[model samples]
Target: MPTLPLYRDDFYLSTAEAYVSAVHDDGAIELDQTCFYAASGGQPGDTGFLERADGSRIMLGETRHGADKSIILHHPLELFHSDMLKNPTADQSAPVVGEKLVLHVDWPRRYRLMRMHTACHLLSVVCPFPITGAAVGEEESRVDFDMSETIDKDAVTAELMRLVNENHPISVTWITDAELAANPGIVKSKNVRPPMGLGRVSLVCIGENSAVDSQPCGGTHVSETQEVGAIHIAKIEKKGKENRRFRIRFGVPE
Candidate 1:
């Protein structure tokens, strides 16, 4: 069944009520609707816990998509150490289908990721180069550009901070799949494209009227530029003859 991705509409929603639609033999639980973000793009999946009727918690290690993008699978933390469901102890039974639960996101970890992901977007705006690769992390993130131009890290950091200080509103808008296909230039990645076939694509817009930047993305980000806070380009490396990797970190450089 296609799980309702609540995060798409509300990134700040950390808790949500959902019914267990299915529970796989491997211990992957599916929900009718979820705020838990499934791993996509360069952002990691959300890790949290689910609360049952009895107030017992089911610690989820990560949220991921199943066979399709719409099918979200929540993997329990216990699945990592051992298969708790394989031999259900009387006290620790697996979550049954149709069970109602409350989802709780690991807010601190998620907030860091949100800040770092937003910083990556700001980096792209400052560089204005085709992104070859990227990764959103808790402490540091990297955005690789498909350019050979030698740029100063300090200069890039200054530009990123400028945008952050400007306090631009970060917002999301949806575009139809056909509309996205019509406007290929909005995509910044050189090799990777935004997830399609789900009917519509999300456009992450910065500034009042997307004056700074607007591109196709499905990753979660902070609501405002100022929320990115104290980010700097820690390093820029030559990955290839035509590729430069910029490392983004939180805080002022020493």
Candidate 2:
């Protein structure tokens, strides 16, 4: 069954009720619906625990997509050793195929990620260069730009904080794949195109009427720029002849 991703509609949704649709041999559990954000687009998958009706907890190490993007698998932490999900032991017990479960997302960690992801977007706005790569993390995030211009990290940090203090409202607007194809300029990533073939794409816009920035992204973000809070461009490193990597951290520069 295709799992309905509840987070796509509500990033703040941390808990939801779902039923196990399939239990993989590797001990990954698939649900009919989930609030857990599956690992994708540089954002790590959600880690939390599932509660059975009797209140026993099944600790999830990660939520990720199966070979089919629609099939989301929640892996038990016990299956993971050194961040890799190992094959299940022969004696390990698994969730019943049709059992009910209540999902819970680790909110403090997820909120940090959400804030960091939004900060990455703000970094793109400040740099205004084509993004080559990026990753959102709990303590920091890095955005690689396809540019050779000499920029000041402290100056950039000031601009980032300016936007953060402005508290620009962030919102998601859906557009058809055809519309996205028609307006490629809205995409800021030089190497990654938004996930397509799903018929529609989500454009995460900042500011009123997208006055600040707008780009297609599948990752989670906070509701407003101020929520991003105290971010700084900690370092700028030259990756190659033209690639510049900016490291963003959640605190004022010392």
Candidate 3:
């Protein structure tokens, strides 16, 4: 069985854990715990590597969830574990049933993703329309919303600029999947939920308006809006029939 990801509890920094499971056939390894964030919650997968006791190392290419939901599929860049199976005998002290390991994630990439993800939330307060869909990424981000013809894109742009000026704080917390299940009303508004059977859920809050905008989420986010100071409405694109998409991005003004 694959290990549960502990890094979701603390996404701002990288973490280390012990060796837990390995797959011989596919040349992959699953640490007892990992700092490598999986690709879920609209936030992209984290990129990094693993180092063994003997100085041998492998690249972590992909971190994704399996069908069973409890197991995580890890794809390594090299055949770091191929030798263990091919050899008739196991090393006297080689990692077998249990061993110690460390998980390291690229901090710069993670920091940027957190900033972008939180900015997307702040955007929600400024953009009057209810969001239909959204995505948070390292380079750019987008949010689509249900629109009325009276909505003015230009006015919304000004509103966003004002929020950036206000610099409201951002925060996060966790709730049992059951707590969310009990309150179906909040879950329906966001249109996203934690993986089924997962024990708990992480929630991201916008400013102090927790009662109004607290949402069930598992993505990384900034400590406060100050970090996401001033975002520009890069573009406003029309999609489908009545839906409109807003493209948002962060940059130093010229």
> Which candidate has the highest TM-score of all?
1
Best of the two (1, 3) by lDDT: 1
lDDT by residue (2-31, candidate 2, tens digit) is: 888899889999999999999888888999
Best by lDDT: 1
The worst-scoring run of ten residues by lDDT in candidate 1 lies at: 78-87
Q: What is candidate 2's CA lDDT for residue 195?
A: 69
| Clash-forming residue pairs, model 1 | none
Candidate 3 residue-wise lDDT at 49: 62
Could you tell me how far off, in angstroms, the CA of residue 123 lies in candidate 1 after the best superposition? 0.4
Query: By summed lDDT, which 10 consecutive residues of candidate 3 come out lowest?
Result: 88-97
Write down the lDDT of every candidate, Cα atoms only. Answer: 0.91, 0.89, 0.67
User: Model 1 scores what on Cα lDDT?
Assistant: 0.91
Backbone clashes in candidate 2 total 0
Q: How large is the C-alpha RMSD of every model relative to the true structure?
A: 3.3, 4.4, 5.0
Q: Candidate 1 has what TM-score?
A: 0.95
Lowest summed lDDT window (length 10), candidate 2:
79-88
Residue 72: error of model 3 in Å? 2.6
